[model samples]
Target: MSALLSLRSVSVNFGRGEKALRVVDGVSFDIDVGGTLGLVGESGSGKSVTSLAVLRLIPERLGWSTRGRIEFEGQNLLDLPADKMPEIRGRDIAMIFQEPMSSLNPVMTIGSQISEALFLHGWPNRAKRHARVVEMLRLVGIPDPEGRLGAYPHQFSGGMRQRVMIAMALACSPKLLIADEATTALDVTIQAQVLELMKKIRSDTGTAILMISHDLGVIADICDRVVVMYSGRVVEVADIRSLLQRPAHPYTRGLLESVPRKGQERERLYQVPGSVPMAGSVRQGCPFRARCSVAVDKCAVKMPPMFRFAEDQRAACWVSAEQSNAPVIEDLK
Candidate 1:
């Protein structure tokens, strides 16, 4: 089976010459058909930038160049003509952004907003579009969608707006959905509902998802494969079960430990120590060396490679890979 999406050595750089900032560097991963791949990292880790790059949504006008392949269903989207993106973007691959209100048109009626995609995609006949919109609203658990059609975004609750966004994104039945922090703004109960909704959509439609967020719990709950990134590079990738049970990289473990567990009693939650470095701050060695508990002399001098630690797990840490019997890889310049 072909992968729904693939990112091969993808890097995103902004600005020109000495002012260039590599926001995403040498990152690679894939999502099999109907698979959920999570990109977990703190703020400025480039998770969101990676997602935008996948969608060709990055502001290249500000002087940016994305290096490497971004393949979707065997087509390198990076090479696809810009004018041809309409057939691919919402029709083949869609995205639900972080904030619902910001993504939605506040002045437009919910009904009109949802119907816009159907119309743009050549779904003529207002009656059929109305029916589809209502069906979509109902599918996403909206109450009396037909009656609520004319309501503006502010009228609905936060969760409701998110559901509306999901409905709009899935309305086209895109084969891939890039959900960038899809549930970060909702309350716990609503977040659970939205997460469950996304899972159901994947199961029902066979739509692959690239879930990006800093929430380990959310990643463990929804993703089949997880990618750990730090300061713009992919440091680890593993199956969700192995990642949650036996994380290979110190960064991955630090993230899991930092989250507040359900029944654990502690004076304070564990922290990874230090914040995510700003763009272009760390230019050598392992990006996490400054904070890694197991860092060695080599970690500060040579960049670590993604060494396979298990059949399906890989990490980019000198000490962790060495401990796992993964051969130390020299500078991969």
Candidate 2:
């Protein structure tokens, strides 16, 4: 099966030499047609950087650089000309950025901003573009779409602004959607609404989604597949159900264990001990070695290669990778 989007051992570094900080370290994953792949991790896990690299939004002139390939529909995005990117961006792949307040222009009306993508993507009919904008607003669950056409970013609530951002992203009905913490600002009700809207978009348009978020619940809510990132590296990748039921990587298990479960009681929430390594400090072994409870001396001495557990799931842990072939704690449980 072909992927709608693919990132192959993608590494992102800022600056050069000793000063260089590897923010995104050798990440690999893919979003198949109409599939939603969630990137879940703590802040600074390089999820955003990976997304930015895919969109070619990383500031190279400011010293950011990437190694490996980011492909969309088999085309290498890194090799595309700068002028060609704008076309692919809105028309083929759109992004709902992390920060609505910063991503949306305060000076532009929501309708115009939403309509602009349509127009730029070659929808020249004025009436048709306006109609599409209204439809998008309504699809995103905004009431009185016609009346709110002229409203500016400042006029809408944060949640409403997020909906507008979503509206703009979906205006072109692209093949892929990169949503970074997409519903963070929305109330639970609106969040559910937005998630449903995304699911509908996937079903109706077959748009693959790269959903980046910290919320496991949100990931479980909307994503079919999951990619667990830790300190700029992909520690695990699996189907959402299998991942929740049987996480192979210790970091992934730690994250899931830390989430507040319905029946689980605790005096203190489980915490992955220690902090993530500074991006500047190059580690020879697993990035999570410092915090992993199950980590062995090998974890500190040698970097674990990404070992495949299944066709769709892989993990970068020697013990877990080895355990996949043998009956152990996770399998016994």
Predicted structure with the largest lDDT when compared to the true one: 1
Model 1 lDDT per residue over 1-333, tens place: 578788998999998778789889998888899899999999999999999998898988979889899999899999988887777878888899999768899899999988998887878889999999999999999999999999999999999999999999988888899999999988999999999999999888888998998998999899999999899999999999889899989999999999898899999999988888885578888889888898999998988888887777888888887777896433332
| Cα lDDT over the full model 2 | 0.86
Any runs in candidate 1 off by more than 4 Å, and if so which? 327-333
Worst 10 residues of 2 by lDDT: 324-333
Clashing pairs in 1: none
- For model 2 the TM-score comes to 0.94
lDDT of 2 by residue, 181-239 (tens): 99886788878878888888888878889899999999998999999988888888899
> Model 2: runs farther than 4 Å from truth?
326-333
Q: What is the TM-score of each candidate against the true structure?
A: 0.96, 0.94
True lDDT of residue 40, candidate 2: 94
